[model samples]
Target: MGTGWKLYYTNDEYIDERSGRCPSTDEFMYYKRLDLCFNLNSPMTINFPVIKTFCSHMSAELIRIDSSDKQQFIEFITANETIERICIQGTDKIFPPNWTFDDGTLMTFFNEDEASAEPDGGKGNIEMYTGYKWHDISDVTLHPCLPICEII
Candidate 1:
């Protein structure tokens, strides 16, 4: 809610100008250079279902940060006041702990803080929150965070 908290795309006109089509969902911003649409909702404690539904409706997937570009992306998101934590598309569902991006990008990058003991090998999906750190949390656990959606 501060000046630092800003949504890049505000209206259908802007979206049309940038991306040719207006997104069905209003809570997204279209990044011209990345050619990606991102949604960073208000700061609140929300569950996976809510985040999933929003991304599904927007025809987008959760944002995935590449390890090669982690620092740059972290700085970008953290600069926004309303976004402290965000739900990305990584989970430990598969054996041998395979983490992947929702958009099918190669999961070649990972930036887990060793101090946090991340990828805790816990049940459920992964969340990038708190000091831009990765944490494994249950899908149903309620936590204060924001959903980052990427146009699929």
Candidate 2:
């Protein structure tokens, strides 16, 4: 439990996040020591709220990479795949910004996009792109991103 990645308990088995082993599930695949189950449901989003609603309807939540291990796991999964970028849970919409996980865990993990200084202005949401580095863009931005979600 000291790994710090969020976990889930059920009639399912929990696998170590680093092992790259995931418990059996539906279309959503699990990853990391968090046993975080991810679903690439393909829901389009013009903003984070849209992604939030889509996840809520699925009884899941937006993807939140809270650790380097989780981030690397994501990169591993995306390697050789055709995904250009995926929207993740992170936003500076608030005065202080909240990159919190759905479980209300504050995000302490960071991987800059390096193309531009993130949060370029005052507000924006986060995205995982090239080399799986994190990028921040305006909330109003519209791009055909691979819709990704996490099931608790």
Candidate 3:
């Protein structure tokens, strides 16, 4: 493999001492590629503990994802049933509590009330929203999956 791509396999490049965030494009690309090596049933975080830890910190907030890397992530999670829910979290004060898709799509999850809503009458059903929704809040196990897919 080329040295230019070495950063992906090497964990040394993702360390962020100050914020503890793995906000690197190279690191994202590495994970995007790593998806090719493992099944969705496998735990992706185990392969990159730094990023896994960083993302776990923000599972509740809507995420701000890199536009360049979002598609691959969406495709991976949607395709792999083993891998459940992905969310974006950030510490920046300016960031919103909720997140929008890089392409400007709105993604959300349904609360118990919304999940049980009936068709047509259940306007709150999150799955009925224009974009994607998680199986439920508890299923949101994957965090920042897209951040690791950013193209360097």
TM-score of each: 0.72, 0.70, 0.25
| Stretches of model 1 off by over 4 angstroms after superposition | 1-17, 21-27, 102-106
lDDT by residue (6-99, candidate 2, tens digit) is 8967543333222233224436665445677776655364577777887777667777777888787777766666757778887665434665
Better of 2 and 3 by lDDT: 2
Off by over 4 Å in 3: 1-27, 30-73, 76-78, 90-152
lDDT of 2: 0.66
Using lDDT, give the best candidate's number: 2
Candidate 2 segments exceeding 4 Å error: 1-26, 43-45, 95-104, 119-121
Better of 1 and 3 by lDDT: 1
Across residues 47-101, which tens digit of lDDT does each residue of candidate 3 receive? 2234334434532122333333444455545563443333332221222333334
State how far residue 152 of model 1 sits from its true place (Å).
1.9
Q: Write the per-residue lDDT of candidate 1 for residues 1-152, one digit (tens) a residue.
A: 88889767555422433434436456565655445566666655657767777777777666677655544554575675665577777766654366655433446766686798886765657777667777777777656777776665
For residue 13, what is the lDDT in candidate 1? 24
Which pairs of residues collide in model 2? 17-32, 17-33
The 10-residue segment of model 3 with minimum total lDDT is: 121-130
What is the lDDT of every predicted structure here? 0.64, 0.66, 0.31
